[model samples]
Target chain A: MKRTEIRLAGEGGQGLILAGIILAEAAAVYDGANAVQTQSYGPESRGGASKAEVIISEDEIDYPKVNRPDILLVMSQLAHDKYIGDLRPGGTLIADTSNVTPRAPEGARVFELPLTDISVNTTGRAIAANIVALGALVAATGVVSKDAIEKAVAARVPAGTVEVNLRALNAGMEVVRRPATGSGDAH
Target chain B: MVGAGGVRLMQGNEACVEGALAAGLRFFAGYPITPSTEIAELLAERLPQVGGAFIQMEDELASMGAVVGASLAGLKAMTATSGPGFSLKQENIGFAALAEVPCVIVDVQRVGPSTGMPTSPAQGDVMQARWGTHGDHPTVAFTPWSVSETFSLTVTCFNVAEELRTPVILLLDEVIGHMREKVVLPPPEAVTVVDRKKPAVPPGEGYSAYDPGDGDIPPLAAFGDGYRFHVTGLLHDRSGFPTNDPEEAAYLLNRICEKVERRRARLTMIESRDVHGADVVVVAYGCTARPASRAVRMAREAGIRAGLVRLITLWPFPREDVARLTAGARRILVPEMNLGQIVHEVESAVAGRIPVVHLGKVGGVLMTPEEIFEAVKGV
Candidate 1:
């Protein structure tokens, strides 16, 4: 009867929807869990606040949309500000420090990482930041296995970009492995 | 029963296309509309690979016309559209209904009166699906709540349409149309397919296209299969020619309506959970059923007797099931994305035997489980 609700919020072109889909595919297809992915987008095609929500459960999922997310990943300042209030108490908040300034809510454990910088430096492209952030989120919370996420990433991304995306995913996990200082105490 | 093997993560729209292909759909004509464009896009890419044809018509009206034409030309044809496009397809849909052309029409519903929120989900077309086309034509509309059901029900739509020789509508709201979920598609061998019953009589052997012998449904003939027949939207006689004789016209119209109405019991599909001995029953369909199901679970945990009766086939509205499910209940709750479309059907079926409450949202936001739970608690 285990269920976890995760929200991935970012600008429209940040690939958050793809990240959510990959995470859902990893959980449902690879991990043998029931998962559903839903998304909301602002009017604009890009540069507008967009959010993708995934609900994973050991049992069949009845309600698909995430209300008070147990895990929230925000890639842009606007997304962080818009969705910060909706995270559950003691929820894990992962944000890209390169683009968003972390604002920890009550009982929220915030992990600030240079997600875009890591993707740009390690993968040589900032376009893989969503994958990088996904790696960090999976590392911070054992929602889905690393192996499953890697397989999902391989199946999802474009053919030629698989290498860089996998590198970006590992770089994201590396950020969480480095030190305890990357995450702030629950406020 | 679909075979239990091939599984994949798929969107509802994508699964619909796969289902259509499995059902022997060889021709598709549609105009791209929000939340429904994926169906056409996939069909455009996949139809050709299967040696089928896909046409992006100038508009929805033309798309429906093309679908009718394709079906007449011995192809299992389909067209997909959203709210505004659905409105435009109504006239031609009625044409298919009257002309007894077997075709599937997929309406991935979006919010609307006219050009409303293009991206938002709404079940506002419940009535439109049944009565959008003019006159008292019998309509068959299947609504699916999940991606897998979308696949199976799309196949069902084609089968029912082909068997009955009438247009069928697969009503899917935007949420189910766009939401991605895991689906294990049964192997193609396990799927059941039904093609339209062609005329048994030879071209010159007194072939009347509208003649069904003892049954209500007539055996349809392809346009160029040596079956010289006239097909028209106007009321026609047994020969398929337009008739001024009142008796022939009445007989034709009654037979068309009875073809579906007489088989209503078999056509209606419903799913009920924990309904027996429950004091409160929630009637829901499509994506709304997801939250209603959760709400029923929560209500049961909280020591409330709540049950769920989900409608899988909307049209030919399962009146008997509605009455049976709500007969002993103290209250019946109908929650839908529209303000109050299906609720009317529930009320009419219940007929004040129970207090039917309408929990509706027209603001394009899905009703959450918490909201439904609160409604259950209030009851």
Candidate 2:
């Protein structure tokens, strides 16, 4: 498809904002797609819920805000409740099993990953969960290459944290090797 | 790519960025907000690439503060903000006016008295841009109707600031800020850049930053140039120190306001389309000016003699031309994103000779062409 809307949601400090920017920069600067990313957060930057929406297309984007998502990734319980209903009938919902007990609408496919635990143990940082969740989404949908996501992450995160985030991405991919949820239903 | 001027498709916000750069702007400080954020984002990226310093300030106040500071340091500095942020920068704007600092402030107006709509467009700041700052100081504000005009007016803003020694406000609505159109980048040699006049006397000689000179404007010596002059918002003498004396204060204030007022010919610019032999005229600026032109064409085609007068520079008000143009017309219609701000100016210029009408909409919605046509029917 020439157009895709991806929504990333989680609690604050999960790097959701940075992940959204990385995806936007990758699409615009690297992949040559017209990408516009918007982010909204609660009052707090450390504890409350946060969401970042990225819209990428071959043509120009008019409204930057996303009313519905083609792919919704939720990293916490609040995120799951906030966005699970926003998924279209045949849309994909990727949830971090350690935190999100997702409830999706009928015909909606849900893929579960232990993103929080993997990020915490692999990177020794709970803050990199957003990066791991992105890797899981890339593995499932293949909208963007894994290497592209890795380079985007490295380019955005602090210089001292790049290697750790890469380890977290690999740890997330290992979880994808095992069958945890629905795989294929083209719509 | 097929338009007048090597036209390239670009957004209005990007055009302002290019205009600031072309005007020899070397310093930019701004806090990112919606609708207006693209200007800062573009400046932050393009400024460094062009050997300019771009700093994202903590808030709009600091952003304006840094701009004034950098300008006093002898660099062409500017800042951009939307509604709520614009409110925060008002005090510094007044400060720049009272201090007679030469700089440009771009207010990419959005909806509200508060943080109402982040993405939508509004033109409610018309009166605010004129009177938001608490003072009787003179002002020069310009509004652009197209992407290309945004660049042209911005360059003019810089030139006016240097020539008049005042802070010029570029009043742009959100629609113009987000709209994309074709514009050709001007060649470097074709653009005329104006720099502030420097002190002619030696360092030790009596060089006042606020003294009256040959043209009633003093030569400003840049900061850190061995010139021991001070700048403050309070009334000061020619040597640039604080003074509470009434005569000195009045003299300083009157000169600052009168200089620009006396030179009205150099400050006012207006564009009229098909105004001759028309009974009805539409006065508009910014994004509204674009659709107003079309509405005038549609009206003319419908057998209603209609024309458009677009304000390229709004502050000097184009009073004399507007008065003359509307004097013979049966009616004048003003359509703005706000309710009755610029309409007041039109009503004043007409002075009851012609029936002045207002078509206004508030809270980020633009006045439709059909609505404008209906308003013009009253003539």
Candidate 1 C-alpha lDDT tens digits along B1-379: 1112444678999999999999999999999989799999999999999999999999999999999999999999999999899999999999999999999999998889898888888999999999998997989999999999999999999999999999999999989998988889888999999998988888777777788887788888888888888889989988888999999999988988988989999999999999999999999999999999999999999999999999998989999989997788999999999889999989999887789999988978888999999999888
Best by TM-score: 1
Runs in model 1 lying further than 4 Å from the true structure: A179-187, B1-5
lDDT per residue as tens, model 2, A8-86 = 9988888887778776655655555566666666546587878877877877553445667988989889988978878
Return the interface RMSD of model 2.
10.0
Quality class of the docking in candidate 2, CAPRI style: incorrect
Model 1: how far is A168 from its true place, Å?
0.9
Superposition error at B187 for model 2 (Å): 0.9
In candidate 1, the residue pairs with backbone N, CA or C atoms under 3 Å apart (3 or more residues apart, or in different chains) clash, namely none
Q: Provide the lowest-lDDT 10-residue window in model 2 chain B.
A: B1-10
Tell me the TM-score of model 2: 0.69
